[model samples]
Target: MKKITIQEIAKLSGVSVSTVSRVINNSPSVSAAKRKKIQAIIDEHNYTPSVFARGMVNKQTKNIGVILPDISNPYFISLITQIQKFALDYMFSTILFNTMLAEPNNKNSKHPLTEEDYLKIILEKQVDGLLILGGEIDKEVVSKDYINALNQLNREIPVVVIGSKIPELNCLFIERNLKKGITTLVSHLTALDHKNIGFIGGEAGVKITSYRLESFKAAMASYNHSVNEDWIVLSDYYTADGYAAMTKLLENNTTLPTALVAINDNVAIGAIRAINDAKLSCPEDIAIVSCDQFMNGDYQTPRLTSMDQHNEYLGKMALLQLISAINGQVEPMIINHNPELIIRESCGSKL
Candidate 1:
């Protein structure tokens, strides 16, 4: 019933504590015979190395801190799963912090955990690196105080940003190419002779919404089509918001656009519900496409045509880049991921 320690394994294996440490750390310096003997004793005793003990010798806690906005969203959930998977493979543990206290329409609202709060915790925990996703980084303008806090944190520990960019702070960024993905979505609609394309969902001041809306405009312009400002509705990134935005658009506009582009699958699904509730058929009356793809999109009345951002790959790459930065092998830089357009029934391609 007692927990066996590495020291006990070393003594039982007839090896020094240093040899046991080397074996536990997977160092090649330990001879094969000694490794076999030590490993057998370790397995027999069910010994596990204390992260604290290893940190004392190597000056590394072998732990990573991850901060993201909301884990309930499928996009963030998938991304975090991949990140945690990669970190575990490399013998690193991840600590997650969900800062979900974002206020509606206000970018500068103080959340439950301030930047200083995160900094203090990270320092106290002595994590080797930090992975930041969403929150203030998703804002069009990051506060100077938050930037200063991140700068100080980066000085003490390596930091990487996933799916957002903070230019003022010296941090590595891994993001999908917003313009190209939106362009692809528009091109698909234009190819189907959809001239009047509308956009739905996304708050006004958020950085991602701004980037995506700009990309939508550029993509539309490329086809010599001017965007209808009336069709462009601004709302939060949720299904109910999308439904309300669509309903408002229907109420205000005498002529509806032939096609609508939702910011993401959640928005697209809600828009589809609103269209059906209005006694209009999807794809037949208004073709719909989404910027992001997830599992639920497939089972809808009409399958959603969406741009796949390869979130899992993004998560894995972010962790790998962070490890490289922690090892002093790479400089802080921006990494862009290209999204793929998936054609399906929602856009009327199959119909």
Candidate 2:
């Protein structure tokens, strides 16, 4: 069988090439009857528009590059899953690059790529847009090299960063309100008479950790409660880190805080493990609340009370913002998403 070009498809369907293109793009301008005819022919001959072929015409690969710190994380997994699902509606595909900046457990992994290297790869592939979920962009003090690479990338294509905004870098930013989430959780615990609440997990140097920790202090002060210097434990963002941090906290402080605010669900789960190891019961002995919700927070031993980041919604919005920027909507959009606190048994709010 001979290859059918877009022209041949248009001729076969009794339409112009542009009309066929419109149908292929799911454009509403095409008449319903013409769309049906073109679609049926598309299905019958299994005629699919090639991304490269379309790119030659419109200079768009219909592809987006997503750079995140770790793929093993449940939050990133769910986020990418949602982004991939929603990208279908826009007839777009995503290419993923994990920077592994969040303490990856993969001892046998691919050659690590710097943020610049990943940016270079994305540019070489000629992706139409870019979405950065986490990594150096979330650092307490971003490096000059990382900033320069991002500056170059922004000049080349539409870029969206789903973290704190760097004023110097001109890109669309979708900032998550980690501070508000912490404030809400702290208030929740305080309302339950948890005055001596300590914070666990997340490295102290990371910008995200600072955001949550600073908010914890502010929230405590707002309620006229003093923070115990001994109860504050800073560790990396992982289960093992959380476990070790909590164990150390348990050991160093004979008198522990009545409750704890975890960096995230994964860390919260780790702290709970440590609690059990110490032969102490969660909620009964120490109430726990997670700053960010994960996939399995509900199934944990006592179930986790967490701040829902709405990853699905965030994923969708990130793609939409990128698309808008790709379409020349270059007015630097900043979206602030406040996390919602989902009450569960972990915090023992009911009790």
Candidate 3:
């Protein structure tokens, strides 16, 4: 059987090979009608593009490398899905790496992978660029060694950090004001006439934990409500850790708050489960709020009232920044997204 190529397909369709290639790659430069025509002809002829030939002509593997701390977490998974949607539209493919930064013994470690392992894979593949989503970048301050390693990598390939530490090396950065998300969640709880509020945050020392905890405290204090230290549950950024933290808060013997604010949707959902196990209903016994709303949150019994971080938008923006950096059109840039509160049944009805 003869394997038809792009040239043969283009010739049969009476169009330029570039047009056929654009249609195969889904490049926006091709007209919709032309793309449909090319795709039909390719389908009829059973033509396939040579991956080697495409790479040789474009000087691109059409591959992006994503290094994330945890792929199982809903927040990260949702982001990956959105990135795929946009990347596919542009005819790009992705390679994923779970850079297990969370330690095995650590209850909070969402990633059981390592930085060195991912770095090695990225280098070996010679990917077009890197999209780093977690681990050291979430730190308030990155270590010298980590910075040095990233700097060395950036010398060869463009790197983009999403919701991670800003490296000294010029790299595109996409992050949310995580503190704002916490504040918005907490503020909504406070407005519900809940004077006594509890906070469940990530591990005490990680960058995300510190930023969110401080914001929670500030927001509570601003409303003239003193946070009982016992009411605050600090643990790792996982559902099990959130459950443990909430259990600790429940056992603390402090006056239970009327509402609760959780670090992220995972923790919030865990806390919700714990509340149910305790025979309590949210907003009836205790109201609840959390950040990083995913589709799963919508189907919950009460549906979560969450802070929308515009994750899909972030994914698209990150790609734009990364491509520009790769083309040397601009230096590394930082883009900060503000958090917005989405009202739902979890938080008490507007008073």
Candidate 4:
């Protein structure tokens, strides 16, 4: 099939090519009547502009490349959905690159991804902007090499970091206040007469995990209850890992804590299963509190008491901020959102 061109549109509309060009480019010189006639012809033919041509005029490829550490996690999954929705509304396209950062691959492999891999993707894909999620965003302890690589990327393109932060980068930052969320959980437990509260946290390596762990300690300390190292189990954010961590904490000799604060709803659900396996009832033998406030948490046998981080809202805000940065309308600023606690039957409070 022959491609539709401005010449064809101008001929069909009974106008000059210059008139069609003015209409297409939204130039002020084009009369409304002529612009409508050209646009109607173009619309009837369903003429799609080539990205290359658009780039020549706008200096943008209209593509936002998203690099996420792990795409499978529910949190990230929800984030992606919201981001895609906003991108579509703005008439922008997105390309995804999943690093699968937590998949336990050999770190000593020959093809380890350096900063160059990221830079190459931007150049090769011709993306106008970039959104970096997860691993790099949640780097609590970043190496000098990691910092240098990120700095290189920042100098080149419009970048945004979602649900995390990086130091000294001119990139928009959006973060859910995990510490406040954890504190809400602790307060719930404290209200339930839970003095001996145990915590199940994420692995020690990542920045988000470390921040949550430290927050948990601080919140617990505020209530005059020190977290027992034996009671605190650190595991990767997986259901099986969460179950195993709960198992380990139970296997210890000390008495089980009256309540458990899980890192996220995923971990808390696993802990719930572990609790049931041990023949103890939730909120009767022990109460369960988690984060993320996933929709499914409400449908559980006993609804979960969790923290709602408003992830979808966060995703929308991040996309809006990214667009602002991409258009050079605003300098990158940190967006710190606080989480709210949703009380349910799992914590045994009717209120």
Candidate 5:
């Protein structure tokens, strides 16, 4: 009762070991007829290639490790869905790691998993490539430890960051044009005569928050308007955070902003609820706009107006880039995707 090996499978199928390996890896290089014959032999022998053996032979496990900050967020969910889909199409398996414990405000965080921690785990697993979505990589000022860990990981396998940039690191980045997206959202609000516009959601010091905040200021200044510091509320990227921020704005400020720009749809939705609790009307008392356009936005009370970051497209592109880099077909590069503005009822746009 000895186990059948790939060598035996190849001999029985009348094909080379490399061809058998290609068939096992689901490579498209094998012809349909040959693939069928090889697969028939494999099935007859009930041959199952050992992952370790295959890795030793080809130096690849055909596994990609994906790390993201929050799985609850629809934006990240969409990205993961698309990434998994694309990986399946290429016959690669995905290992997902949710780094919720690594977020900024975890006071009781025992094992604060950083990019380095995940990289170590993924590397230990011997994944072909690594896809990082958020956490320390999204920070405006990345720590030395994180950067050093990332550098070490890059030397081993292809690393791709989605919607984040790590300076001085030779990692590939797939990001949306945050500045353009924020400016577009602000300009749209200004065009509708929104002068006193406030921002909600996203913590201070985060790269994404700074990018949108700075872009919002620049966009306001372009229209000869000034950003009132009192109206700006920085909070975590969550619905509850948005609600609390909006409530604080209403409670503390003498005069509320005519419109508000939320970091994402979750914040926008929560802000809308806050306004409702205060018996205030959206677009009448205050208009609202969001950066990330998710499916939930369409069914919201007012239907959120948002900048579509194209999460699915970004995910697909990141996987493609990672695969290419893994295959040595492309060098490390940055791909910036343009965000599209989806004008809906929340922004008070007639069109």
Candidate 6:
């Protein structure tokens, strides 16, 4: 829809431009009688005031800077889509920076600018706030330089991280309940009469990998099952990484885990292919469960039985948190998002 000028709106509402501006900004100086009339005209016309004009009063550009590790990853894609949708509700725009550091297929490609480099750009752009997902902040031990950069940035603008909560910086954090998802998957496999379970994918040293692995072990121990160290493989987050890891497990050991929990859907698909290439069937041979669910999970050969981290909901909550921070409604804090188990053929649940 075309946006009409504020002057046109004021003229239509039979009020001065300053009166309309005051009404748009919710200035208490405007009388209720005029405020109600102007508001009704705004509602009827669906008029959205310009951010530049609003900035003069609120000192906000109304643009949010969204920084994520990779755009190629389905998880970030799903999450960012929701962020953009909700930002518009408050007349805010999102400026996305795809760092491309975690792109599975483009590992060999080189990018000159690091995440901090993008932070400088974001500052220059003068965004109202920052929403960061899965980058240096997701490391178990984030670099001092990165932490310094983030702290400096936070001093200027509110920063929200959709990952781990760093003690060094007082940035607000929104994290997934990694233990619940992992424990729930293990419980499902155990209930299905599967005793031996293994894990695949996810590189070590990353905060997410550590969280999932810890939860996987704890979950298995909870059910009186021992974790097989040999079957547990730590690799990158990619289809090829999963294929290679699974193949290594299949080749080296005749004794295998009855069930496997993958790091993500990409790894699960690769593991399934490796299982198939070895002349084995999913569920019938080695039931698979994925930690992360993607958009195309249902279309896989055997639909993925995975943990739905509710990325969309996470994204929405992140935006809301950022909005709250922008409005000075919150301080540095953490919100834990709950993940759900989505069952499908891959886990032998359908069979």
Candidate 2: residue 350 lDDT (0-100): 83
lDDT for each candidate structure: 0.86, 0.88, 0.78, 0.77, 0.87, 0.88
Sorted on TM-score, best first, the list reads: 2, 6, 1, 5, 4, 3
Model 2, CA-based lDDT: 0.88
Error of 5 at 326 (Å): 1.6
Per residue, candidate 6 scores C-alpha lDDT tens digits across 1-351 of: 668778887898788989999888678999898899888888988887767878777788999999988798888888999899989877899999987753432567685666777889999999999999887788787878788998999999999988767789878888778889999999999989999999999989898899999999999999999988998999988999999989999998889888999999999999999999999999799999999998899999889999998887888889999999999977644555788899999989854
Q: Kindly report which residue pairs in candidate 2 clash with one another.
A: none
Ranking according to lDDT, highest score first: 2, 6, 5, 1, 3, 4
- lDDT by residue (92-139, candidate 1, tens digit) is 999997767544423666645565576678778889999987887778
Q: What does candidate 3's lDDT look like per residue over 1-351, in tens digits?
A: 888877788888889988888888778998778788888988887777776688779787778888887788777887888887887776678898876644443457565544654676697898888888777767676767677778788787888888654537566677667787877777677667787888885876577778778888899899998988888888876777767877777777557888888878888778878878878788798888886776677788788898888888888888877777766765656566877888888897752
Residue-wise C-alpha lDDT for candidate 5, range 1-351, written one tens digit per residue:
688888888888888999999999889999999999999988887888777677667677889999988899888899899999999897689999888766354548786665567778888988899998887888888888888888899899998888665568878888668899888988888899888899888988888899888888899999888889999999978899989999999999989899999999989988999999999999789999998888778898899999888887888889999999898865655566889999999989999
Off by over 4 Å in 4: 1-52, 101-104, 107-116, 334-336
lDDT of 3 at 175: 68
List the candidates' TM-scores in order.
0.86, 0.90, 0.82, 0.83, 0.86, 0.89
Clashes (candidate 4)? 1
Residues 96-194, candidate 4: write the lDDT tens digits. Answer: 877763323437665666543655666578777788776654666666765666667766777778755655665667766778888888888898788
Which is the winner by TM-score between candidate 3 and candidate 6? 6
